[model samples]
Target: MLYNNITELIGNTPILRISPEVHKLKNIELYAKLEFYNPFGSVKDRIAYGMIKEDLKDIKENGKTIIESSSGNTAKALQILAHINGITFKTVTNRIKIPEVKNILRILGTDIEELPGLSECPDPTDPNDPIRFIENMVSQEPHKYYHTAQYSNMKNRDTHYKTTGREIYEDIGTVDYFLGTLGTTGSSRGIIEYLTEKNPHLVKVGIIADKGDTIPGIRNVDEMHEVGIYEKTLYDDIITVNSLEAINGMETLIRQSGVLGGPTSGGAFWGTLKYLEEVDKSLSEKKTAVFVVCDRVEPYISYIQKRRPDFFEVETHKDTIRNLSNEELANVNTISIGEALEWVEENNPLIIDLRGNMAFRTSHIPNSINITDNYFEELIDAGIPFSNNILVMLVCPVGEKSNKFVALMKKKGFDAYSLEGGIVSWRDAGYPMKPLNLKKKEQAVI
Candidate 1:
């Protein structure tokens, strides 16, 4: 395993066969592509080096900074590679939800330019898209920066095809099914395209997070369309897994198979099992399936603790939104855009916007005060911030977060309602929105 340089250790990661006793699949042999074994500790290492290796000499000689839109592994790998080769690396992204990932990037000397966009996936409509920002920067001074646009770059997929796909085929020939969490869609696209040539019947299943849910390194179903590398036709089926399901799946993999993978890996595993269970019932022959273990879980400790505080023996409030029962969630009061408009005029309810301050300053419902969802949760932890007498309304990007909060509020005896379809619906309904214009000094204070 000796190598002259770390880049030499980028690919050829081992694939582990899951024990039948663990997965409990009667007719299928399930395997996990243990991609975390890569030198940079994730599947992205292959592409990180692939994207820059050919151009490394030119980039170094020209003194061009390596830049990309990445919040996690890709950024980490590129930064390390850039440093080792005497090239500056910059990460422009809005998807850094995990604090540890951001801190790790900073520790690696990554020049992080964080934008205020909320979605982990690209939003073509969003003015602050990281890819769009990078494109603008490169266009203005092309020689100064080398933009490795992972989402759109063919190199992202080509590298995976040449290495990852080839490695898998060599280890386990003619994979019947390939399941992978869709981030840049590079790995899935490259792997499936390669595998399909070997086995025409190979089922390619793409995993995504549920709508309005966050799973680090993967896009939600609603956001998938905005990704340039994503092709709906490429996947035989698409599956959605939630944050809780992802963690649960990760735990199962860790305890049962000793695969120390992250949430994205867990999501792929969860989706794979869910899809295969039904297929197994009708199968007569031996079939093989593979899912990717994208990265290790150490970086997501805070993310895990926030969702499952009881794991750490921390005291959790009974009325927390995450703890809401199915019945409570189903009963959350929600008002449609038309109904909300008339209701607002008559009831004069206290409107609370749960989006970030930057988004709030851009545009929000008139007279609604921005609290940001995290701070709003803290206020609830302390006790009722408002009297039960006043009618209240909760707002968010979509209806999801507001719906969950409203469920908890109802449990606490608050007369609250969530705006159906949230602020997006209100905007589409042509309701007037107010934008707060803050001076430079006031912006700094905020």
Candidate 2:
């Protein structure tokens, strides 16, 4: 088990059988290929080490700083790889909300440049956007930086082909289906290529995030791209899993099977369930499928909280025992994020962030107090700061749960109003959601 460096510990991640209740329906056997067991805690550890180890000459000569645009995991893996190799690394990314990923990149001394605002897909016209930003940097400073651009990098997919794909075949000889989330298309491309080579009939389900959804480590439908060795024609099925389903899948994995994986893994699992449910019933019977566990779950706690703390009551009000009508629900106190912004300007509003701790830390209205989930219980535990003069505003990813909570808070004699449209709308309206830790607002907004 001894190794010269952590890079040596990159591949050979363990795969475990997943027999959760939610996945029990169609006589299909699901297994999770746990890439988080890798040293840097994600599958990207494979590609990061693979690319850098291949380019020691380039790194030693001209790679003053290893640079790339990333959603998070690959940049993190590259940061670790760069640290060991005595090279600096920089990241060009959008507003990455995951606290764990951000902290690691920050602690590693990564020169991160964050793009302001959210755009579902990369706009070709915008020079300061995600995929384009990296291109601009590499084009501008080819001598000063070496870009490990995962999207278009052949080595990115090739590494997975050589190691990740080969490992699965060597471990479990007959994998009926290979399910993977589409990120840089490295993992899926590699696995699909190798697996299909062995069994031409192997079902390749490419998982993608649903439209208007932002699941980290994987691209949504709007952001889809075919870069590097990515062959779109190879996929037997392309499944679009949305954000709520992803959260449910992640929670199921953690609670039922003890598989703590990131949102991409959630999307992969969601894809598997969808494939079984909607795809041909003939393939559903006694099928063996392997899904990629892309990364560990620590990076997405905040997102998890926004969904609901262990309660998928987003179908909503089930636990209320007394259902509130649509008119009653509509009557709950509310304020626009703009109005809330104005209130905050003149006076202090006790902004009770109902999103998880990490999400609050990632971005929240200034001077807001975060309350944990199990809503009423956590509120009681923290003790109410309610008073007649005090303005209390509740926040969540969207306004649904906040509106529900406002109903409960009003009955509790607290003057609480849900911030209409939640934080997403606030950001959508071009209001600034401060990137908490990073000091440079202009240079690096993450």
Candidate 3:
């Protein structure tokens, strides 16, 4: 695989067949398109290279540096493309992105800028907010930089249409459904647009994070954080999955396929499986579903190694509870600040603050125990009991992590609930906090 330019490595990813038993769907063929083989080790390589070339063509007429904002994979792809093209590149991302991605970006000589106050933003919407900030910077300093606004860039889709989409269509011959995670919607949308032209009945499914009104593994209308403006018009259908479902599915994929993809890949796989189940029940004819294995397992190695090492070796199917709707999960057992106080007075329930120790030390629910991530597993291992008959509340800085932790506790055979809006909401609702005080003695000025 000798290539003179990064752009030359844009398309032609390998397709592999996997056992249907692992996916838990009967009488259906499954295939995975390994997009990680791209130059940047993800499908975003095509988009990054395409957007840069098009933006450069429109702006510089000759040659110029590139600047963009990306969370992980896109930034790495852009770095590779820029390095090959002899263009200086700068990437702005938040601090909480997977550490391996930051290291790769640094290795590629990208001028990295970390956004402030981004740790609390759990979703991709806020994580991608740096795009606007970078746009502002490029507007003021236009001479030396070009911004590849991936969220809104048509080139992202164009590259996929020109390369990945065509390659899949040519290789598979007939793809009943195109499944992939919905980040910018470039990969799915591009393939849909290209393939639909040939096969009008082809289905395009976009997988989104479960937030509002959306099903756990199917589509609905919600403010998708990673879905860009282009996606609304691009996707034929959308599917949403909660964090737990995504995590569990990721574990399942690693166990079955010996491929450890990230959360987004798991979401896509789950969406495809659910779709196949529905199709199997409805149609008699055999169906073939294709999903994009969007990225490699390397960037996520550390995360899975630390949080779910058991999944690294075993491929056991875990049953996920999907009876509770997102709305039910959002509001179930949630209490307002006043209501929480009143409930605590009446029930005397144990409130476990899920926020990290630092935030818990700053201030927390009155008399709540600080069981941070560091000590959470330890405490659970120590046989800390939660009375099933009594109310148990989990609290965090914001609601997302608390919700996830509550789900984990529930899965671990505990009747637990999470405080909606967490500590921020409690303070916003006029709750008082007991600030920690350090022991200090009067001393002479030194």
Candidate 4:
């Protein structure tokens, strides 16, 4: 096939049938929509084009830079498209968890402004949320920037409805079930709308990351709120898959079916089987179902290795938090908000905040030192960085991460306790917080 421009190569992706022997579903025909076949190598290519193509001329004429709040595939696609169209592109986001994804965006000449909060989706409560930050910037200089609000834009959903949904129906007449891992929730919403017209009884299942887990290109329960295009009523069921399960699903697709899909695709595959397994038992006839293979897997090598180090043959410390036993996890020393003030005064423990540097600077527990979670993990991998006799108190946005670290530290014979409910609780309880004064600190250094 010959193409005049790369934009022409955006849609009409091929779908593959999962072997009956592999899925082992008695009455279901499973299909994988190979979205990675698109020119920029992900399902986001469709939306990137959909969001920008109409405004490309106006944006170019006005010399406005195209901007969005993306840290992954959407930013990559938009950057490439912007380059081809002779326009500048910028992305403002929270700390991108995947190193490879960040490096790729940087290499593509994307102007990235990284914030401190770790939520993959927009958080309305967060003052430094990417959407709010972009809105502020656009308000200040509307002529200087063109913000493509992917999270709320109807164009994102409409593009999928016109192309992705139409192509799937043309290939397979009617879809009995549709499974899609939710990121911006655009692709899933678009497909469900179109396919439901073909078969009103179609089951729409939305996939997300489990609470306190990070799966790239999807939102966890806390981050799911405040998304403009997402509606809970659209889905028949919502399934939560963790990083391990997502990787397991990715491996299954790669090994069993030879589909080179990323963790997001793996998550969708995992969630699809979980939901359909129950439906299969009650089904009287064979039904067709489709799930999207969101992207290729090569970019997420570090992500998979971090969660499953055994796969890469990289050994962790014998007492690493990753290897914490259930007993150790259960027995972590925890202090509530009321107890925290008294405990801090009595013990004088070395307080450690595990939130990102940006958040740490905004406001944190007085006398607390900031070591972002990833760096802290690296410190543990080398060996414990603290004295055995010293008392330690760990804190995070919420208590979950800090609790896990406390468990590992306790196993290592350190007097460590996790602050119950974390810094959020401490702030809510009217405890004093010290804000880092950047100007004063810089002047002092000079």
lDDT of each: 0.86, 0.72, 0.66, 0.87
- TM-score each candidate: 0.94, 0.69, 0.71, 0.94
Per-residue CA lDDT of model 3 for 1-446, tens digit only, reads 57776567667888877787787666667888888777667888888777766455555454656777676778778777666656677787653336676677777777888764343324222223577778788788777678788877888788788887788878877877777777677777788788888788887777777653221222223335434635565567776666556667776778888766676667677778876777777767776778887775666655554444466774422322234446545544566666866777787777776544334555656667755533454455454555656568877666655675566556566777777777777867777665334343111110
Worst 10 residues of 2 by lDDT: 118-127
Best by lDDT: 4
List of clashing residue pairs for candidate 2: 313-316
Q: What ordering of candidates by lDDT runs from best to worst?
A: 4, 1, 2, 3
User: What are the RMSDs of all candidates, in order?
Assistant: 2.5, 8.3, 7.0, 2.6
Evaluated at residue 92, the lDDT of candidate 4 is 95
Q: State the displacement of the C-alpha of residue 348, model 3, in Å, after optimal TM-score superposition.
A: 16
- Per residue, candidate 2 scores C-alpha lDDT tens digits across 237-276 of 7889877788778878888889988777877887788886
Give one digit per residue, the lDDT tens place, for model 4 in 140-233. Answer: 9999999999999999999999999999999989999999888899999999999999999999999999876788898887778857899889
Task: Quote the positional error of residue 323 for candidate 1 in Å.
Answer: 4.2
TM-score winner between 2 and 3, please give it.
3
The clash numbers for all candidates, in the given order, read 0, 1, 4, 0
lDDT (tens digit, per residue) of candidate 1 on 70-92: 99999999999999999999999
lDDT of 4: 0.87
Candidate number with the higher lDDT (2 or 4):
4
Model 3, TM vs. native: 0.71
| True-structure Cα RMSD, model 3 | 7.0
